[model samples]
Target: MSDSVLLLRRVRERSGEAAAAAASGGASSSPGPAPRRKRGRRRRFYPEHRVYRARSSFLDLSEEQVLRRYRLDKAAIAGLCRELGADLESLTGRSHALPVAVKVTSALTFLASGSFQTATRDSTGISQSAMSNCLAQFLEALQRRAARYIAFPAPGRPAPPAGTGAFPGVLGLLGSMHVALRAPSENEVAFRNARNFHSMNMQVVCDAAGAITNVVAKFPGSCPNAAVLENSALARLLEGARPEGAWLLGDRSYPLKTWLMTPILFPCGAAEERYNALHHQALAALRQTRALLKRRFRCLDAAGGCLQYAPQKVCQIFLACCVLHNIALRRRMPLEPPEGPEPDPEPELPLQAPHVQISSEARAVRARIVQQLEFTVQMSCESCAEAVREALRGAPGVRLLELRLEAQTVLVEAELAAERVRELLEASGRRAVLKGMGGAEDGEYKPGWGAPNWAGGEGGGQTGPGVPTCVPVASLGAAVAALSGPGGVRGLVRFLQVSPQRCLVDGAIDGLQPGPHGLHVHEFGDLSRSCDSCGDHFNPDGECHGGPEDEHRHAGDLGNVWADADGRAAFRMEDSRLKVWDIIGRSVVVDAGEDDLGRGSHPLSRVTGNSGPRLACGVVARAAGLFQNPKRVCSCDGLTLWDERDRAAAGPPPAPAPHL
Candidate 1:
């Protein structure tokens, strides 16, 4: 008993001693819940002061090097930094923001080189994610300031410096270029272009000084230039504003409108030839401007590789590049060497029939300037005549100058003022007297010299004085059949001759896929073997297959029809080719694929317009009236099953039958 009590006392004392040691150690060392784990500081790749210093001293690079690397001079970079500083600070947060210069440099590197984000990160010394964020933010800032940097000159302003001998009053040059990109996951076919590259078609309008004034950067690369122009805000602006006496010079890829001018298709006379020459000279500015833009911003170069971004993002990048280009021009930065080949000519589309009219006073003014003038010069010898000829030959606006020594007279054809010609002759030390103004009396002007062929009479070959004022109405019924399936597409289409050159076509077809389908009028009305029996497009003029509005195209080319998701397509278009009186008994066919309007690189484009197989067929027939209402007729001849059922239920109207 004595030994057990002593052991228990020893154990109790040891336990108390152990508990005290544990509590003291826990309070001093273990602490409470790890002290809530302090967030670790991010390791700096470079010293913060160094980053700040790098940004602040960005202009330390020579102007040439900066222009070569970033397509911006030191002044431009500085201006951009100052302009974007506040916005950048707000986006990145003042406390942890990267220097404004760093963000701008990252964006400029990407734009100047058209390099990928990873490449940009390596050059910028920033993480790829940070660079990406920086690019997005920079683009946003540029877009906000775009209006300030890029703007068209106001109406009545002096024309920008067009190339040598450019057209007068040309406000800007309109053109488009392709920006290559990786194919999108959806609608990849829609973005595949003639070059077989996925891209975006960017439309740009630049002043003669090569400064971009406007940009529309969202059209799919496969879209035709004409279609893009026709569907752009620029078109609406030109249409509504109709900037007085100002014209946008463009290549044939654009249509001829009052506010937009294109080169004459087939120039007839000297005046027309001169106009065409000037138009081409003016349009050269656009081509050179595009080349310069791509040269300065290599990211836009096709050689830089397709941009790896979504379509919308790619558009933003394009617009941002345009803004920077304008800014660079403002800062007088020299352009770099072009990075790729010049863009190819755009595919042709249906030409829009020009609706502009030339005023009589304007025509007279043109005739007066562009005319043959005969003047009597007091020349004594052949040497004198030779001297006069040499002097007139070097004149700026002279088209042709002839000096006759025997008659002592001089004849000149030019776009020169009468007083300027007199002064030139007088300066040559020969007294000259004006004889005739325009090689003939004012009332005896030649057919093609007074006004543009389009302004006077029917020049497009489709419209003439002999053409009827009103085209008759016509209707066509289609029995559509899927190329590979048992189901069929069916619809009725009506055509009305709205004017001498325009025919309005309205129809609805069911059972088509929800995409673009080729629609055309076939040459034959035969339906013996369905659409296959119908010949090729109704090309009576022996013309190429093109859109209905094309200057030289098959009469049957009606272009494309887009179907809705519900497999129904309703279309109404005013076609300049389809005269209601011309296509009677011909067949209308709907095709399986989109129509390339005869401009596709594929061989089938020449014949079938690259539209797949015929999916539906119908015969054209004369209609009693335009848009004849088909729904007015009775569905059933005043009788119904319900009426019969009621009569039967009422015991067959026995009393009425007896009275009869």
Candidate 2:
């Protein structure tokens, strides 16, 4: 028999023997010293449940403190408790029942603090077991009444305020945010967003007043915005009702529809240009509302880190927070700036899209809107256009580029962050301002660089064996220099003679703002006055300071390298005139601005390209190459090769130049 069954039978047998003994003793009319019982172990008893009276109520805090901690003032909390009512209050008249306010407070603390382990114990003095009960009840209440708090405006409601760029019939400003979450146990890969973080994509629509009118949550992070909209309940409702002239303003990611308005990807005329500008203004309401949600409910904020909960629980928690956020907005709860790192300012762009058919009515509406509106990056010339293209040559996640010289606008469609692209453009010595963004349809007349295929491409596994672990080097003539300068400018440049007439130059420098800097070899390696003592450009042939491609240029003229947004300049260039053996002991330098290629009117243009002040330089010394001296650790300093690599990777902070 099973262990529990056997134990139960044994207990029954013992009880029967005790009853029989008591009956016999009573029949004899004598106790007989209680049958001389013998004792060994005592029986243990446990109560069915334990009543725990918590130490303090969170309601003891001041009004201001309450607003900051729970994101709801006392009056609002009271109203919420009454709304939840007996559903939150203890049902029994047992010893010191937990008040409904305590349960509400515990749930609020959990949401505001974004933690389950300490939120309850620290704020409400309740055990996790009790907190679980409170939070579950809170989510249940929200689930039942979420519709009451969040709803779209009535169809006949007055057109939105003119403050939203004076766009008539704007039903709401639509936006999407990715809510980070703990990796789910099942289907985990789907949770990875475009940023490669485990999260859930949440779509929201807010009115001009910054209240959330509709929210769709629980979609996978990898799911694109257009796909989310196509599958959302709101989309279905809009399609069924077909509200005339009323529409939603979404970013370029969303597909244009009759009831969903999107910006023009390429504004060819004054009307289309004005439409995009006004569309941006109307988008502010959605951004503000989304920011406020994450600020108040940190569980959704990335700064708070990923939410530590199951995938299903995460959805419920977000839903509950959204409902509470609407309630807070209605009650005029003030926005509080977080004490630490804030959420990302730019919203996540829906970089990928699934196939979806667009109605002809949608295009008709967009064309009509463009005719009604009139309004207005500098790609004014071919050189400027070429500079932009060169900067973005190898940029990752970039898909499309369309530049218009007449309009001085460039349309870039990329999965990459806008900030990164901006840095690349500035690196070309040109200011790039993001006017706006919109989607590109299939078979559109795209100018400039043809878009890279976002789907499968022509690459597969390589046929030939890849390079070995050994670093490549030029054994014939190789030299190296470790460059360090003022304000954290530092780099390692390697010079190698690859052929009889060609020399290879490559290195990576850090600690520069996003832009171009002149690179050249100086006449001397002297450090007596830091960079000032490096003398002029190494013009052994008495040539002018020109670009690497110029025949009449100095042997030291290596041109410029671009720095990305993170202040890292990585470059590789080849020069025919730069002989590795000729300039072994000379110094290479970087300037503070673009090399004008002897084209400027300044007297120094032919001598220094008017490329501003010398920033950093280093002396060249012969070094081993081509599988030579490939040791792991240095015998003299005891520094392992990996250690050296890590040190270079960490980089140095900005400081004054070193002196001899």
Candidate 3:
């Protein structure tokens, strides 16, 4: 301690002597003003306030140096650095590349997270203020540089060299718009961005390969795809892409203009005609084709139609499908040789058979049948237009008029093509007008000149102005019954003669199952399957019963339908207690799995139906008076059965099944 103290004293004495020497040399030192005394008697200068500046750290250095020191991949860093350099050049005049990388990292982090301070600070280790500046610079650079990448490419052609024309690809143009909420004001407390933001409709043009070609974002109030297309960058891009004779496909939402676009028609387009004669012929052929398909395969569904073959990619899947369709047409279609017009057939058959005299009674019967046919045709025509007009009143910008000339009776037809239809419907902003015909065309008479009134003309000449028939939703059940059978039960009911004297329950499943699954009758036709539809329990008599084996069990509690090895469930119950006719608004549900009713410790798993998901649903119906109902309606038992199987051989039976 003595030596340390002596050394400290010597240093102090030297400091003091130096001060005195300085003062003597006119430095003006009076013991440095007694070293600044404190208010306390024994106070001295504070050691902490020694006036030393903090050293700067390399941690604030630019991104490139950090990458270099950190031994990052040179190429990746170089690429990123180049991007940063470009961004920096675009944003600011400074050419130094160091700050660009920092800005790049900052901007990416900011855009991705929507928080400039947090994302930039965390990613680039830059201060908050620096991060904000970098982000601003980055955004400005991006807008300028984006011009190179956003141009539209031509469809079905090769892209020119870099300095030449644009690229070629099949463009799949789709438009989607989003509405933004309004911003919060001084008077209102801020809730969410939705309340204050404006929405943007994005018209995105994608290639058949599903790559994005061009995107135009705007906020035009209530504009439809067609209207938007007319004004959008995508429209311009598309015009150039498919210069001449290129196909443009869209849903019915597009206007029916006779532009170069080929509007791929849906099933509804089957009715569209070319000319008067050809229209009828084409329609007949189409109808026959559809009938044959339904009778033979019954594979096509109204909704799925052709989408089953579409690719998994979401953006340009439609375009790809079009390409596939075109390819298949090229390879597999059978072309017919051109034909010349044939001479008209002779008015009379060439003496194939000699005329024979007929009884007066037979002649009278034939006359009666012809008279009935005439009545039916007349009634059908008068009712047709009203029905169609009712269907179209909700459609805006559509006008209708009856076409009639002296003695001729025919339905005049007019239509906007599918694309134009889409456009107009969008402009009107109403429910989309799917494939359908005009009011006058909705009726039943064939086109041609009408016979004189007393001669029994088919056109009933509107016995009076036709009364508009309002479709009653509740009458669906009775309607189905009339269409099928007398009692509303016979048409769908099958009397399967399991044995000659024993007629077990018969009838095949209708639309109950697409393929096959577990089908069954619940104890509660009431559909206490849930409380909503069917009333309470089928019995509600408070009968005590348990399990499928219980005889006293309520009607609403039938066990499983038990499928067969082929996954089809076919069973016949002589339970005279089960009434199929009264079961309207009730249904036969298909289950994906078997119902064990919580038996066994495995906890009775329901794989489908209540069992799991409801796959397909069909309601029971009885066609009352609508003759030749176009929609398929079933018998009381919900089967498409007929008595023709009585004398004729029955069709091959369904395969045996098992529970789902």
Candidate 4:
């Protein structure tokens, strides 16, 4: 035999011995010679032929040597596939370098499935060492290939002027981040290590033509997306790159960090939030964006299985799909049929407006174009509508900054009244204002008095009016529980409360007890169970009723309390049988006139809302917790109750508070 033949046989024999030893040492084995081949078994079915294994290099193989050794012959591979059951012309072809291509595809498939190296060895008839070397070389090649296909050059690196000799018109820049898969275990680790990284984040910036302008991928340790540009090859290309007057758009996740590349801001107005029915167009567009994002999320979830090295790469691939989306959008697809055979020439007519109004139309077409051009600015995405709405709803003393009704979007500016924006949004009748301020405590100020016969009166055995009281409930915990409770009183109602801690004005017509005044409960304790359960107006009777004089009846109809000339209406009429708390769900209405013990003719009546001109309203508390009156009652324009309080705290006419 030739020296080469002798070396090959010896190497094969050694490899077999090593494998047998490893298998024997790994687990228990019978001490016996290998079983002889069965009579019916094919002659070719030797131990080596029966099991596929990775080919080993000739001990001197370098990285280049290994790659060279596996460089599959195109014709030979095709013939081999034909000899097996696989079709060559049908399934494999010229564009693909068969066995080598198959090798690449198989590696990718293995990367995705996470099959063991042993399994791969069996399938490819390759040795463990050869398979390992193959993987490293394959990945390096893929990185180069993907760079050619997916990565973008940095900003300043725009290619030599297009063959057309003019830069593409209306360049649009889009950016997204994706997770790359690193390992099967890395997926779980990525979620847990919020600050660390088990996968790399991939960022690609694309141009109007959907060509990649920049590409970056890196492990997100403590670094942020803004910082990524500094480390990536894509960023190097972007150095000194200026996308002047370009329209750059991104989701909320994009940071506000200033970049050397472009200027970006949200498309929505300063006060106007996104997504809250900001006219029909915004709403529709927002819905479409949401659906698209949802699909992207689903794709990301599916990628977890295939991406092992930086598991998030699965997500990175998914984000690549976004670039495809932009390309599709640019193509004006799903394509439409030509309107007619006689297609009109491109006209100078105006484009349709998103929310067609003089202001909106003007802004979208002329103003926006001019403004962005003058400043070389890009536009960021509108905040998620749901997020903005939830914020607006919770903010206390929220001022409506701008309400472009034609645009149908409400812009509200509010200082944080609580720990979270949601808390402020949830309050009842929480209307956003443009200016001015008023709340429960506003009524507390003495606003001038009524006649001796006024509602909660004093003097002459009749009633006199009193100032509205705005008191904080002591227990917020109780309040939350009460309102959320099963029997919690909600909505409109009228009922009496005999307790010193609670008060309610009547809305019922019969005076609830005739000949005298009857107090009642309103609604909304927030489950506070505080004195402020049941908010205003209990009167079931629409017209203001039962006062000293005859007038139209109103909802707050309790008549004047009996008192002497002294300014006081004090009486304790508590009956265990006439439970007040039970009546919380109901109203205690007063009459159009005094119930005069069922006597006195001439239609015998008095006061309108029982001699009370809408004295006060306190929705009883429930579980919602202590209602903190806004420090500033804003009319909405930006004025706050705080302004008044600060003014008051400053004191007197001669001294204006010094501006900070």
* Least accurate 10 contiguous residues by lDDT in model 4: 370-379
Tell me the RMSD of model 3 versus the true structure.
Answer: 31.1
Could you tell which candidate, 2 or 4, scores higher by TM-score?
A: 2
- Which rank order by lDDT, best down to worst? 2, 1, 4, 3
Q: Candidate 3 at residue 510, lDDT?
A: 27
- Candidate 2 lDDT over 482-549, as tens digits, reads 78887778877766553324566757788877899999898898988888888889998998878889
Q: RMSD, each candidate, Å? A: 27.9, 25.3, 31.1, 26.3
lDDT of each: 0.66, 0.70, 0.32, 0.32
**Model 2 segments more than 4 A misplaced:** 1-54, 156-165, 354-357, 373-660
Candidates 1 and 3 compared by lDDT, better number: 1
- Model 1, residue 467: what's the lDDT? 43
Candidate 3 total steric clashes: 48
Lowest summed-lDDT stretch of 10 residues in model 1? 472-481
Off by over 4 Å in 1: 1-57, 90-96, 156-164, 336-660
The total of clashing pairs for model 1 equals 2
Superposed model 3: Cα runs more than 4 Å off: 1-80, 84-98, 155-170, 177-197, 218-227, 236-241, 247-660
What lDDT tens digits, residue by residue, belong to model 1 across residues 57-157?
45667767777778888778888899998777655465466878989988999988887898878777778888999999998888888888777766546
Query: What TM-score goes with each of the models?
Result: 0.49, 0.50, 0.27, 0.28
> Model 4: per-residue lDDT, tens digit, 1-660?
899999999999999999999898768765678799778855653454354334332223443332223222223223323443232122546432225444443443244234555566655556566556555544444443444345443344333221111111123243434443444553365332232434445555554344454455544423444445446654453334644332233332332212221111212221111211222221233334323322322232223332444443444444443443443343433322211222211111111121211222212221112110000001112432333344444233343333233322333322222112212332212222112111111111122432112112111122244522322222121110111112221111222221222222211111122234433333333324433343443434454333323344333333354422432223322121222333334323222223332123434233222222222223332211112232244566576533542332111212221321
Judging by TM-score, tell me the better candidate of 3 and 4: 4
- Report the CA-based lDDT of candidate 4 relative to the real structure: 0.32
Each model's total of backbone clashes: 2, 1, 48, 134
Worst 10 residues of 3 by lDDT: 369-378
* TM-score of decoy 3: 0.27
On a 0 to 100 scale, what is the lDDT of residue 657 in model 4? 19
